[model samples]
Target: MRKPVLTIFYQYNPWQSTIGGIQSLINTFIKFAPDTFSIRLVGTGADNGQVVGQWHESELLGRPIQFFPLFTLLDDNVRKLVPTTVRYTAALLSKTLQSDFMHFHRIEPTLAARGWLGDKTLFVHNDIPQQMSSAKGAKTILWQQFPQLYFWLERQLMEQFDQVLSCNSASTKFYQQNYPSMVNRIMDVRNAVDTSCFKPLAPGPYQQAKQQLLDRLRLKPSTRLLLFAGRLHPQKDPLLLLRALAATPPESDIHLLVAGDGDLKSEVEQAIEQHNISSRVTLLGAVPKEEMVTLYQVSDVFVLSSRYEGLPIAMLESLACGTPVVTTDCGQGPSLLTSESGLVVSQREPQSLAQALVTVVDNPQRFTPEACMQAVSPHSAQHVVEPIYNSMLQRWHVSQANS
Candidate 1:
C-alpha cells in the first residue's frame, strides 16, 4: 500500500527561528510522522521584491518543505488594497490538494474560504478571536478590533471540517461551547516537546557559560532565581511580574531573569526600574538556543506570567530540565502542572502571584525535580505524538475506503 501524502499549511516558514507555537507543531509533525506519512509543508517565504512564486525548497529534518514567496514587498496599504497574498495562498492550496489528507494549522479565514479540505481534513484550534473578545467584553478595546468577518468565517468553516484537534482542554471547552456541531469530531491533542536538545544539562562548556552569565550579571550566590521567558508583550504581562517582585522587601535575595525580547522591552525595563528592583532584575535579552538548556538546568524555578497561552514549550522544557514551575492560571498548560508539580496563581493578579511566589520559596520541598520530569512524560514526542500522527493517517485511509 502507498503511504498517504500529509500536507501541512503554515503561515510562516518553520526555519525562521521565531519563538512561536506553530514551530512546535511543525517540529512535532516532522519528528513523529516522517516514516508513515509523506510530509509536504507549505509556507509563505521571505518578504522580498518578488510578487508570488515557489521560491525555494529544502529537506528539513528529512521532510520535503516548500516555501512560496508571496508578495515580497508587502506594504500595509498595498496589502489592504489587493488580496494578492490570499490569491497566492489559494493557488498553493490548489497545488497541494493532491495529498490524501489536509491539516490546517490555524483558523485562517482566507484559507478556510478556499475550500481545499479533503475527506479527512483536520482543524487544529489554537485560539478563538470571538470567544476572547466576548470574555473581555467591556475591558478589551484592542481585542474588539479583531476582524469580525474573519472570526465569523472561522466559526462557519469549523463546522465543515471532518475532524478537529485542540491544543489543550480549555481550547476543547471553548470549541464545544461555541461550535457544538464539530464537538463530536474534536479531540484533545496537546502540543509535544522535542527532548533531543532540551534534557537536563551536565557539567561542561554549558556549565562554564552559565557561570560567566552569573558573574557578568552580578547575581549573588545566595540569590534565588526566578525566570520569566518568552515574548515581552502585553499578553505576556511582564509588568505584572515586576509588580509581584516589587512587593517583596528591598533586602530580598532574589533575582528575576527575563529572557526573550519583543515590543514591550522598554515598557518592561521601565517597570523594573520603577519598582526599584533594577539590581535584582536581569534582562538577559535574547539568549542563544544552545545556552537555554544550561540556564534551565541551573535555575531554581521557572515562571511564566502570561495572560494567554496554548501549551507553551518553555514550560515543558523547564520540566524536562527538572526545574519546578510557577505560572499564572492563564490557560490549559499551567493547569497541567497540578498541585504536585508547581503552583498556579490567579490570572492577571500580581498580588496573588506575589503570595504564591513567597509560598513557593518558603516551602521549597513542595517542588521535587524528579516530579517535574515525571509530569512531562505524556508530552514526549516519541511516546505521545507519534501515535496521534499514525492514527490521523489510519483515519484517512479508513475514510477513503468507505468513500
Candidate 2:
C-alpha cells in the first residue's frame, strides 16, 4: 500500500532566527508531521536583496522543509507602508492556485489571505479575543487599513478555515463564543515540545554551558537562576518579571536571564536601570536554538509574565527540560503542572510572582525534575502533533468527498 500525500502551506512570522512559540511549533511540525505531508512555509527573508521569487528547500532535523519568500527586495523603510505580509498576501492572492491546506498562525494573516484559502485550511489561533481586543491590536494593519471591518473580518475569516487549533482550552472557548457559527471547527490542543531536544541534560555539555553563563555573570554556583524566554512584547510583559525581581528581598541569591529580543528591548533596558537591579537581571537577547536548550537545562526555574497567552511553547519546552516554572496565569499551566512541579500566580501581579519565584527556588526538591518531565510528557510531539497531522489529513479527505 502507498501512503497518502498532502501539501501544507504555512504562514507565521517572517523567516528569521527568533526564539518564539510559533517558530518552535513550526519546528515541531516539520520534525513530527507525517512523512506523507509536504511542508512549505512562506515568510519574508532577510535575504539582503537576493532571494525574491525563489523557492528554497531545506531540511530541519533531517526532515524536508521548504520555504518561499514573496517580498525580499523592498528596503526596511519601504516596508512600513507595504509590509512583507501585505506583499506576501498580494502575491499569493494573484497566484493561479495553492497547496491543499493553508495553515496560518495569526488572525491578521488569515484575514489577509482569506480570499485565497480553501476548505482544508487551519488557523492556529494564539488568543483571538484577548490579543485582538488589546491596544496593540488597535494599531495593527487590519485596524489601520480597514478599521470598520476588522471585527467583521475576524468573524468572516473563521468561516474559511476547516479547522482552528487553539493552543489551550480558553482560546478554544474564545473562538467558539465569538464565532459561534464556526464553533464546530475549533479544537483545544496543548502546544507541543520536542522532547528529544528539550530533556534534562547530563553533565558534559550542560555543565559547560551552565558554568560559562555563571562565570560570565560573575555569579557563584549557589545563585538561583530564573529564566524568562519569549519576545519582549507587551503580550509577554517581560518588565513584569523585572518588577517582580525588584520586589524580591535584596539579599536573595537569585538572578534572572531574559532570553529574547523584540520592540520592548529599550523599555526592558530602561526598567532594569530604573529598578536599579542591573546585577539581578541580564537581558541576553535572542539566544540561539541549541543554546536555548542549555539555558532550560541549567536554569533553576522558568518564568513567564505574559498578560495573556494560548499555552506558550517556551513554557512547555522548559517543563520538558525538567525545569520547574513559575508564571502568571496563562496557558495550560493550571492543568499541566502540580504543586510539586510549578506555580501559576494570579494574572498581572508582580508581588505574587515575586513570592512564587522565591518559593520555587527555595524548595527545589518540591519541584522535582522527575515531576516536571512527567507533567510535560503528554505534550511531546509524538503524543500531540502527530494526531493533529492525522486529523487534518482525515478532515481534508472528507472535504474532498463532500466537494
Candidate 3:
C-alpha cells in the first residue's frame, strides 16, 4: 500500500540558518512524524533569488524534503506587495494537489489557496494584526490605513482551514475571540524542543563544557553567564536587554551572550559602547543551531526581553537544557514560567528585567536544574508530535470516509 503524503507550505526556506520558532516546529514535525506519512516541504527560494517553477530536493534529519520555489519572476517591490502566501499559492497548489493532507505555516497561504485546501491544517505562529501593527515604515502605514479590512480578511481566511493549530494560548485566544463561530476548530498545540539534544549535561561533562565556553570567551570562573538568543530586532528588543545590563552594577559578575544577528546589530554595538558595559556583553552573531545547546547548558540563566512573541523556541530550549529563564511576559512566558523554573516579570522595562536577573542568579538554588528540565518535559518532541500526528491521521481518515 502507498503511504499517505503530507505537504507543508511555509514562507521562508526552513533549511537556512537562524531559523525562527515556526521553522523549528516544522523541523520537529518532519523529524518525529511516523514513517507512514511521507512529507514534502514546499517553500520559496527568496533567499537566493533562485529560479521559479523548479522543485529542489534535499534531506533533513534523515527525511526527504521537496521544496518548491515561487515569486522568482517578480521584482522585489512587487513581491513585497503580495504576501508570501498569496505569491506562492499557485506554485504550492500545483505541486501538492494530490497530497493526502496539506499543512500551512500561516493563514494567508491557506486563505489564498482555500479552494484547493482539502484536508488542510493551518498553524498560527503569532497574532496577525499585532504583528502587522508592530511593523515600521510603509508597512505600518498600510496596516493603519486598512486595519478593519485586513482583520476581516484574516478572519475569513482563518475560518476556511479545516483545523487551526496555535503555538500558544495567547494566539489561540486571539483567534477564538475574533472568530467565535469557529472556536471549535482552533486548538493550542505548543511548540516543542529536541529534549535529547537539549537536556542537562552530566556533572563531569557539564563542568567541562562550562570551562570550555568560559575559556573561549576569556571570562573568569566566577562570572555569571546570561544568554540571549534571537534576532536583534525591534520586536526582540535587544536594546532593552542592553539597557537592563547597563542598569546592573558594574561590580556584578554578570556577563551576557548574544547569539543571533539582525538589522539592529550596529545599534546593539553602539549601546554596549554607550553604556560602557563592553566587557560584560559578548555578541556572538548568528551562532549555528548545533552550538545553541552548549550555550544554553553553560549559561547561568537564559534571558528574553521581546516586546511580543508566540512561544519562543529559545526559552523552551533554555528550560530543556536545565537553565532557568528571566523573560518579559510575552506569548506563553507568563504561563509557561513558574517559580520552580524561572522568573517572569510584568513589564518589559530595563529595571524590572535587571531585578529579575539578579533574583534568578543570586538565588540560583530556588530554580533547580531538575525542576527546569521537568517544566518543559511536556514540550519535548516525543510528547508533542504524537498527538499532532494522530490528529492528522484522524483528519485524513475522516476526509477519506467523506470522499
- Residue 258 deviation, candidate 1, in Å? 2.1
Over 323-359, each residue of candidate 1 has an lDDT whose tens digit, in order, gives 7888877666666796656889875677888777766
Candidate 1 residue runs with Cα over 4 Å from true position:
46-52, 62-64, 69-98, 109-113, 117-131, 134-143, 146-151, 202-209, 286-288, 399-403
lDDT of 2 by residue, 1-403 (tens): 2343344443332334565687688777777878777777766556455375577776666777676665554232121455545566676665533567666765555645566645445546355455555453333234444545767766766677777887767778877887787788887777889999999977687778788889988998878899999877777888789999999987778999989887678889999999999988888887778879889999999998876677788888999998999877755566778887899897566788999999999998899888999989988989988787788677667867886
Output the better candidate (2/3) by lDDT.
3
Candidate 2 deviant stretches above 4 angstroms: 1-15, 48-50, 73-87, 111-119, 134-148, 203-208, 395-403
**TM-scores of all predicted structures:** 0.82, 0.87, 0.89
The list of candidate 3 runs beyond 4 A from truth reads 46-52, 71-98, 127-146
On a 0 to 100 scale, what is the lDDT of residue 314 in model 1? 85
lDDT of each: 0.67, 0.74, 0.78
Ranking by TM-score: 3, 2, 1
Candidate 1 vs. true structure, TM-score: 0.82
Candidate 3 lDDT by residue in tens digits, 90-195: 5555553436788887655665566764677888776554555644223322444577786777766776677888887867887788788889998888788989
Q: In the order shown, what is each candidate's alpha-carbon RMSD?
A: 4.4, 3.5, 3.6
Backbone clash pairs for candidate 2 read none
User: Any residue pairs clashing in model 3, and if so which?
Assistant: none
Question: How much is 340 displaced in model 2, in angstroms?
Answer: 1.2
